[model samples]
Target: MMMMQKPLLLLAALTLCCCITSLHAYRKRGCHCIQTTHNQVPRKCIRKIEVIPVSGQCRQTEILITRRNGHRVCVDPEEKWVLELLTKLYSENETSSRTNVSTNASSKLDA
Candidate 1:
C-alpha cells in the first residue's frame, strides 16, 4: 500500500506541473489586448508608443500608447491618426539612421 501511494503521489505532482506549464504557455501565446480604442489620443500626452504587428497569436496589429501619467492605452491600428503617426515616426527613424551613418562615415574618413 505504501509503494502504491508513492507512485500515485508522484503522478499527481507531474500532472499538476504539466497543467501549470501549459497554462502559462497559453497565456504567453494569446493576444495582449483585451480591448482597444479607436478615438485619437493627444500627441502631447503620449510618452511612448509601441507597435506590435500581427502574428499567429495576435490576429490584428496592436498599438500600445504610454501616456505621460504612466498609464498605457491600446489604440486601434487602422485609425487614420494612428496610420499617420506611424508613418511620421518611420520617416523620422529612417532620416535619423541615415544621418548617423553619414556622420560615422565622415568621421572614419577624417581619421
Candidate 2:
C-alpha cells in the first residue's frame, strides 16, 4: 500500500506540473491588446498602423497604431474613424497595385 501511494503521488505532481506549463504557454500566445480606445487620433500624429486579423491565437481583430511620440495605441476596430482610415488605406493599396501591374505590362510590351 505504501509503495503504491508513493507512485500515485509522483504521478499527480507530474500531471500538475504539465498542466501549469501548458497553461503558461497558452496565456503567452493569447491576445495582444488588453483593451481598445475609442478616442480618434489625428492621422498626422500616427507613425505606423498594424492590423492583426482574427486567428486561433487571438479571438478578435486588433488595430495597433504607433504615434510620432513613440507611443503605441490600440484603437477600437468598429469606430467610425477607424473604419474610414482602413477604407482609405485599402483603396490606396489597390490603386498602387494596379499602377504597378499596368507599368509592368507596358514595360514588357515595350521590351
* Candidate number achieving the greatest lDDT relative to the actual structure: 2
lDDT of each residue in 1-111, candidate 2, tens digit only:
999999999999999999999987865576768999999989888887777778777889888888889898889989999889877866676666654323321111110
Residue pairs whose backbone atoms clash in candidate 2:
none
**TM-score list, all predictions:** 0.61, 0.62
CA lDDT of every candidate: 0.72, 0.76
Q: Which stretches of candidate 1 lie over 4 Å from their true place?
A: 1-29, 99-111
Error of 1 at 64 (Å): 0.6
The most accurate candidate by TM-score is 2
Score residue 100 of candidate 1 by CA lDDT.
39
Off by over 4 Å in 2: 1-27, 97-111
